[model samples]
Every structure is written in C-alpha cells, then in structure tokens.
Target chain A: MDYDPMVMDDAESLGPVVKISQADNVRVKFELSNADLSFANSLRRVMLAEIPTIAIDLVEIEENSSVLADEFIAHRLGLIPLNAEGAESLLYSRDCDCDNYCEHCSVKLVLHAKCTGGENMSISARDLVPAGDRMHQTLGMPVIRDEDGLGPLILKLRPGQEIKLECIAKKGIAKEHAKWAPSAAIGFEYDPHNKLHHIDYWYEQDPKTEWPPSEYVDWEEPPAEGEPFDYDAVPNRFYYNVETSGPLGPDGIVTEGIKVIQQKLAGLIHELTEGEGGDNYDGPRSPEYGGGGDGFGYSTSYGGNGGNQSAWGGAGGTTPFGQTPYGGGGNTWS
Target chain B: MNAPDRFELFLLQDGEKKIVETVVNGMSNCSDFTIKKEDHTIGNLLSERLKQAPNVMMAGYKVAHPNVPELFIRVQTDGTVTPREALVNALKQLVAAYGQLGREFQKELALRQYADQGENGDGSGAQGGTY
Candidate 1:
C-alpha cells in the first residue's frame, strides 16, 4: 500500500473493471473488461493453487477390515472437503512450532464405521467426526454434501467389516496436492472465437464442423460471422465461471484469490524498496552478489557460473544461472 | 533433479531471490529485467500495462523455459519515464485492480444472498453457460 509511485495514478484511474454477471451458492459468473489475459489467468491460477484449504493429511489406522486397502481409504479421506471457512488461521504443519503436529496446526478427526446389520453398507464421509480442541475453528461439524445431506460414499463394507482411523486435517494449497484444491470447476475463457489462433483444431475436413466456436461467442458480437479476421486481436475481455468445492463459496474463493495476488505483489514491492528511498530505487542494484547464507545451495555462489551448462539447467550439474532449474510449476508454499 | 527452494519466492536472499534484476542501457533508454520464481501471471500483466504507460516506447516479456519460474521483461522508454517508474506504475495498477476485484466480488455475493432470501427458489438468472 505504501511505495508511492508519485506519478498521477493513471492505471488506478482506469481501474480493473470487473463485473459479476451472476452469483449463487456454488458458482459466480463475471466479466473482466479492458484487461490483459495475464491478470485473468493469474486470478484463475491463484484460486486454483494459492488459496489454502483443510484436508486430511495424516491418517493413523487403528482397525482396518474393510475391503479397501489402508492407503486407499486414507487417500479417499484426504479427498473429502471439510468446511474451510476460517482456514487462514490454521497454521501449516511445517511452519508450526510444535514438535511434530499439535492442536494449533492440525485437527484430529476420527472415522469409525461398521456394517452391523446390513447386507452391504456404504461408509460415507459423514462418519468422520471431528474430535479436537480448535476454539478458532469454523468447520467443527462439517462435511460437504448434497442437498439431501448425504456425504460422498467412501467404500462399501461387508456384514462384519469395520474401519477405524484417526485423521489429522491440516491447511494446504492445491499446488502441493490436488486434494486441497478448493474449486470443483473453473472456466476461464478468452478469445472464444479463436481469433488469436491459440487453439489448433486438428480437423481433417473442416474446422468449423468438428470444432464449433465456444458458446461464449454468443455473449460477444460473434466476430460478425464472416468479417475478415484480424490476426492481431489481443483479448481485452475475459469470462469466468467459478464453482467452489464446498470448502469455500464462489465469492469466498475469488476474494481469497484476489487477496493472494495482492500479497505477492506487495511482498515484491516491499523487497524492491526495502532499504532505500523507494522513489529513487530505480534499477536492480545487487552489489552484494554472493553474500552470506547460501543455504539455498552452491548455486548461490555465482563464481561457478560457467558458459557450459544448459540454458534451462537440464539434468546437468549446474548452469551459469545461480538457481537450479526444476521440472514443474511449483507453489511457493511447497 | 533438485527442486528450487519454495521459500525463494519470498525470502529476500542476497545471493538468491533476484526479484527484479534489471540491466539498464544508458544510450538506448531501455532495460531488461529478470524476475525469479515468477511465471507469466505477473510478467504479462506488467508488460501489457507498461506498454500503455506514458513515455513508454515498448514492453514485452518471455519465459526462459517452461520448467523454470524465471521471467524476462524488456522495456524501452522515451526518456520521459524511467523503466522503474514504468514498473511501479504497473504494480500500482495491479494492486488497485485486485483491490477493486475483491470488493466487487464480495459486494456481488452479498447482493445475491439478499436477493435469494427475498425470492424462493428463483434460479432465473442464467450463468455464464456451462462449457
């Protein structure tokens, strides 16, 4: 909020004009007008990967005589979405000050299911009962389910089969594991007419018959059906259909995602103007190239930056660049 | 392969965490900035906004590799505004954009909730049609 740009805030004058066309319990439709695709994709990715949610991370099986394996049942438990209404207060297990995991970082949930008198019974997520001391918790008696109040069917059990386990639910982002993802569906559409040629339809006969334009074409002008297409059309509008996975509502997910973006940008702003009068901190001035604490690695020691290593830091040892190249787009929380 | 440190995104390490490493050309009034642990989200947003800033000649960005998180941005200004000023402008815009977005979303959510309460099962509003 600080780092005064000192100029007439023209970009702020334009503002990021986003409008919610419709909103409900599960989904919200919005239109971002006069903005770049980068911002659109950033919002989508942040909501998908940055916003934290509560999921079962550690499962201690006490008794398992059901048909499914322990790990299989554990994985299924991890996928169940608990109400993460106040997940922000929950500490990540790695960042907690406790020895391993304490009540401050994780919640203890017990799942005990037995087929007493049924031919074949289905153990559901409704059976996982919360048993912890989290006064700050907002999802105390929570299991996402349909309007019929029936939780997801986990596994089937025989007449005498029973399963009992203690699950530790922790806060996590989707980047580390997909089970923590808060959104059930996210529809991000730009350039629906394919005017930008971003999509390549592999049609043998006709591209039109095989690949019709996205239904979003009806929202805009449809490019006038046969108007001469301009190859240089940058998308100035984006449509989003965001649906939550019961942990957070549609608006909650979006607002949380927007907050994450703000935090990232603010952190960068703070670093950029940390020690100097930010007004004059014009360019990158890293005179302290290889200072203390190379805990990141020897790559922090730039003296070994030779001209030989691969550009992308292939399986080779090191590159001229200071950091090691990785394989996937990892979250900062990982 | 060893994964890059996850904390590299925030911890302003001296040797690492080159948030923005810019090389300014004195003669051409252009600069190239390399931001670490970032993807196209900020890259494209800043470049597009920088291109629209006053006294800015051109702005563009590219990722070094699909596997790497680094991003490269090249900006040429017309001497009126420095490259850093242009970047700051873009950053400020992004901040305001997100701020407005959050407020608008929350506002719309409240409005819908209130409306839904008044009418019973009024699912008349058509959403951005399911894909």
Candidate 2:
C-alpha cells in the first residue's frame, strides 16, 4: 500500500516475471507484475474479436434437396474455420479496390453431392471443395478440423437426396460474426495470496469461535507465532486461457491478436502525427511504420507492412470483380 | 509424463505450486489442457512466444467454455520438432531476448545525455548520417 510513481510510468519495462509453466503445447502459465486489470482484459478481447481468420461470408445455393434450407446452410458454412495461413497477405474486402467480390479478396468453394445408393449418408466439411486456380492449396481443407481429422457436419442426406451450393470465404474478424471468432473461449483471473492462520492457538484461548475446513489447522508442528493470512489482498497479476476453434492453433491466435492490436495503435499514431508538421504528407503511411519497436516495448522485425503477400498485394489489376453479396437477386444455377 | 499426460506446475501468488493438467492431447493437430487460474496475461504471453518458435505450424489456446474457467492450448509443429519442445524453446528464447533488451536500454541511457536547448533549435528528432 505504498505510493510509487515509477511503478505507474514504466511498469511494462521494469516489471519482474515471477513464474512460468506450461502443459506441453496445449497450455502455458506465466506470472508477471500486477498492473491494470482492464489492460489485461483488453488483450483477451482482442484475441476473441480482432484476430483475422477466414470464414464463409457469402453463399449462393443453386439447388437443395437435403433437409436444411438455403439460408440455414449458409449460416452453417459461415461458422467453419478455414486455414488462414496466407490470409494476412490478402486485403480486407472493405480495403480492396474492387467494388464487390474478386479473386484477390475471396476464395470460392463448391459442394455438390447426391446419394445414388440405397444407404443414407452424412455430409461433412470435407465434402466442400475449393474451386478455381487456388484449389491446390485449399482442396479438402475444412474451416476447422479435430485431431481425429473430422470436420463439422454440414448436412445429412437420405437416398436420392442432393445438394449443390457455392460458398465464398473471406478474411474477417469476430466482431462481424461469431464464425470469425478465433477462439471458442478465453478468460483470465487474478493470482491469489495465501496465508497460514494459527487456528488451534486461537481456538484454545476462545472455545466459542467456530472454524470451517477444520483440517487446515497444523497440529503436528504448531509454530510459536501465528502466520498472518492475506484474505483481503487483491492480486494484480493475471492468468488467461485461450481455446482455439480450429482454423489456427491457440498460440497463432494470440500472436495474430497482438499484431492486430499493435497495428491499430500504429494506425492511430500515424493518423495523429502524419499531417501535423510535415508538408510532405504521403497519401497514407504503411502500417509498418509502427514496426521496429514503435509502441510495443520489444523489437518486432516483421518487415513489409505485415499484410497479404500474394494476389492482394497488387494494385490496378484487370481482374473483374463479381456481384455484390446482396445486389444480385438470386443464385446462378449452372 | 506419459504419452497421454503432460503437466506443468504454476507457482501461484501465495507461493503454492498448482499443477495444470492436460485433459485432451490433440494427437493429430491439436492439444487441449486445463489450468485453474482465470487469466489472460499468461495465455497471451505464451501464445505470443509460441508463434515465434521455429517450425511451429500452428499454435492456439482457449478457455474450455463460457461457464468453465479452465485454459487450453494446442500447438502443431513441423515434423522436425514436437509441439511441447517448440513451446519450451519459445519461452527460453523470449526470456533471453527480453533480458538482452533490458541491458541495451541501460547502456543507451548511460551513454546519452539530455539537453534542454530551448525553441531556437530545430525540434526534429531526426539525425543525419550516411549509411
């Protein structure tokens, strides 16, 4: 309960890491200086809502003989977590130059199936096929998969039933929809303080007082002096957990979430400082200006704007854009 | 730790060691585990470190559910290394790098001198030099 001005100014730089532990690749635990709880919570929110992952955004159904309706099927498809390895290189639809959908901004997946035999069958995400030029990398890729190689079920079909549909996957954040959330669950808690109380000594003197969890008393080697219990203490340090929804590993989700936070901070700094003093205001500074330890205390040498690397990187391409998600009246059956 | 079990002991604020157990090992491409603590800082830090590990294909962690307070992390790695090994390496590397950064900061502070030469001087922090 002592005042320390230095603690507020450079807690990040000066804080000590007291402990760290991990359970293989699945979970890790670490303890550092207790700072603002809100700041720690912000990191959790960023991981759940800001990290970019690929999900089905627009769907066009040509035919449906299965039980699920077109809109219902689209909803199910949107929740699938696609492999987002190269998504950072791709541009967000809002940032793209195209008026609507384009190859640079979207991936096309088609699913066509029919039950010809007498036996009923189940349909899974594996049945969905990535179409067009990007097929090689995306074929048989599920939005998410379990360790057993099983994907979420899309629909079940009886004999003679069929379904044909086209889905467009795009990079987005969970703020848009739950489907884009990188993690299914995430949370953190404050570290607790413990104290030993000499209950036996107090009980012997005052027999009227009652104690719960009676086994806690140390009868074998009772100390001459009682240890003070810190029940009222509020710990500043926190621990958190992240359960991945499958498109990426939990670690990847956290890393991407941190990057997104850094980028947003960088964007703010660029916006506020760009036109202030320099008449040489370039159109828009690359988000990379925030790199090289701009805001985050550590050095991040991830050069080159940290955006998409392939098709989306180009500007003024002749590739024609497709119809808007809602502008087109109905699905184009072929 | 057996093939199905891996555990880590977390040193709590009260100096009590709590063991976090792995309930589900993602054999093919995932691993799921639980910890008693409710925390975002540790999970975020570990995941951030894992992302920088070499040969790590994908790494992820999450709370089990909205009602549950346990944490789970799953990591996938290239054939060259196991996910568990990759995570340990990441933590070691981060500690070393951060320690080095602290020393660098101290050195810079010692070498540089602060001056308050008023508004007459150009305020730009830029220094001119031939690379």
Candidate 3:
C-alpha cells in the first residue's frame, strides 16, 4: 500500500496543539486534543519528578487569550521575573533527586536588570550556566553578563523596566532525555505558498545507525528490530478531529470523534453482511401457535345441545347440597 | 450481482438546517452514495465502508445501532448531526420500503432448499449451498 508520507507524518506528529506568534510576547497558547492531553499529562508527571513548583506568567494579556507555561518547565526552572527567595537548595537534595534538580542536575540563574528599550527580551539557562557546567556541580557564579553588571543575559525592556529571575538548580539529563524536550523544535510547519507541510515525527532511532544522519529525514525508530513497529501501531493511527467550537471551548479537544468513526465503520459492516444476499439467510420456523384453527376455540364434546351438560355440570334452582345458588329459596324464615 | 436482501435509508443529517444548507444544496453528485456486499459480521462491513469514504467532503453515511441487523442509508453533510433523529428516520424508511425485500429473500432461500431436497432425494439436500 502506498502511504502518503505527509499523511503519515501528520498522523504521527500529534502533540499539544500550540499557537504562538512572534508579534506577541513569549507566550504560547496550547490547544490540547484528547491525545495531546495524554501527552500533556504524561509530560506533567515527568516534569514533576524534578521541578515541583509551577506557575503561569501572563504578559500582554488579551481579552480572551492567556498564555500558559509548561508546568514542568516552570516548576523546574522558575519562570524569569519570578524568584524562589530561599528555594535554591531544593536542587541539590537527593531526596528531591529528579532528572532536573539534583546537584549535578540543575542550574539557577538570577537575572535582575532594567531593559534599556525594546519590545522583548529572551533569556535561557544556557546564558546563565556554561554549556559544559550546566549539568556540572558548581558553587554560585554569574553564568552570563551584559554591560550593566546584570551577569550574562539579554534585556530589551524599556528604561526603568526591571525583571527578576529565580531559577531552581537540577540536572539537565531529564530535560535532555524527556520525550517532549523543551527546545525550539519545529513541531509542525505548513507553507501555503509552497504547499508543503513538514511535521517533526519523533521516535527513538536505531542507536546502531548514527546519532544524526547525514541526509535530512522525517522519521526515527529505536535500534532493535523488536521495537521496530511498536510505536506505529493500529489504534495509534487515528487522529482526534477536534471541533473548533462547542462546550469543549475553542481550545478544548474532543475525544468522541474517534468513537463516532468507529460506529460508522461498524454500521458499514452490517450493510455489507446484509447486502451479500443469501449469506445470512436462515430457513423459517413453524409458527408458535399451531396451524390456524379458530385460534381461541376449544374442541367440541360428544352429545347434542339439549343432552349436553355444561363442562361445569348441571345447575338447578336448588344446589346439590340443597342450598340455592344465590339465596336458597328466597327464605323469609332466614 | 443481486441487490441487497434488505436496505435502509437514513437522513443522517437533515440538510434543511441553516448551517449545512449551503454545502448540501450545492451537491450535484450522488455517485459517492454506495452500497457494498460481504459476509455478515459485527464490524467488517462498516470498516470497509469507512475505508472507502475516509474523507467525506460533503456528507456522511448513517448507521443503525451496532446490534440492530438492519440496513441504514444516511444522507451526510459536512456538519455536525444528532444520531437520534438520523436513526429514527432510517428505521421508518427501512420499514416502508425494504421490509418486503427481507420477507421475499427469506422465502426465496426456503424455496431453494425445498427444490434441493427434491433433486437429491435425501434430507441432507436441505443443507446444501445451492441457495
């Protein structure tokens, strides 16, 4: 069967449906489908392993739009402009040993600076911690700096505009190995002009081949053949068709679409079976009631009408015991 | 080659709804409306139908409840629908139009069995596949 790579890629690349615009602040509006919700819930659990504190920072808020940060990301590395005053040691504790916040696990960067003037400012852990030392154990030190002595960082805020940063330290291994790694990955790309839609189809490639292949490719699978088709199985093939409106809300995901499809498919099965002519035919059975007589009538008895006694027996003015049926013989004495 | 023993018609979505009127009114082709025949099983027939009409641009097929052994003809439109209304209409139409086909088909099968018995001169002929 010839499968369209585009369709395959789209189906496999399902994830949190996020919409981000450069014109807006560094905020992403995530619309999660049923499948995406599972991904989100799993990602949330994984993130909670290391970073336990999470909060959403809304910037340049619109009337009906709000931006949400990944809970795991926020919990591990505090969002910039927010600080953990004394929560720095939470990163070094083994009891709190998550992939993100152990001694060799995390890095905390506190950036306090007034932006000279610009529409946006971007900062990341790499800017504060040295690339090699990001996961290395180290005492406190400034990782990056700007001319204003605010350490290694970038600020585009207007004059007198200040932002505070509180970062919790942890290991980078989890962030590195997370299924949904936090990076500038092009989740999906569609160009109306080119009519080309490229989706990032993530899978564990064969460790036997190469880390990064020479030529560009859209798919990956694990090393062993045993794991070859594990992720790309049948039930996983269906994509949730989220409605744009309803009680689910514009950003809400609907799971009932798949159920609806399954039902239709079942109905088709019925049609096919019945349509196949005599395949399902079975011979008729004898009627429940015997061959038609006066359906309710009883069989006749032997004697003629005058000689025939009723089935109950003869009834006279007086009963067999000498008491009349209703009032014995209108007895005035009684 | 035989027409279906019984067939059902369902208006899965009423095209009269204002929201679906525009697309349904413009549909000039009923060629996609189709019927297929296969051995009766719980899900096989419907699965094949879905594969045949994966992306129904204008309308969708209607189906009776999963357990009901009846045909369903649904008129689909590229919009949302209530399954209840669709099912009621389908049942009504099936009774009115295709009910006789089911009875006649049953009779035909019976007659074929009787004829087989006469030819074989044995009771086992009733179990033959000639029908």
Q: For candidate 2 chain A, which ten residues in a row score worst on lDDT?
A: A318-327
lDDT of each: 0.66, 0.50, 0.26
Residue-level lDDT of model 2, residues A125-179, one tens digit each, is 8888888656226422575445655588889899999999988888776655678
lDDT of 3 by residue, A28-48 (tens): 122222122222332232222
Best by TM-score: 1
Cα lDDT tens digits, model 3, B1-131, are: 65422211111222111011111244432222333221122123222222223232233444344333333333442233332223223322222111222222223333443555566675343233311
Q: In lDDT terms, which candidate is top?
A: 1
Please rank every candidate by DockQ, starting with the best: 1, 3, 2
Error of 2 at A96 (Å): 1.3
What TM-score fits each model? 0.75, 0.53, 0.18
Clashes of each: 0, 32, 25
In model 3, how large is the Cα lDDT of residue B22? 18
Q: On TM-score, who's better, 1 or 3?
A: 1
Q: Rank the candidates by lDDT, best first.
A: 1, 2, 3
Cα displacement (angstroms), candidate 2, residue A124, comes to: 0.3
Candidate 3 lDDT for residue A318: 15
Q: Could you tell which candidate, 1 or 3, scores higher by DockQ?
A: 1
Off by over 4 Å in 3: A1-102, A116-156, A171-334, B1-131
The Cα RMSD across the true interface for model 2 is 22.8
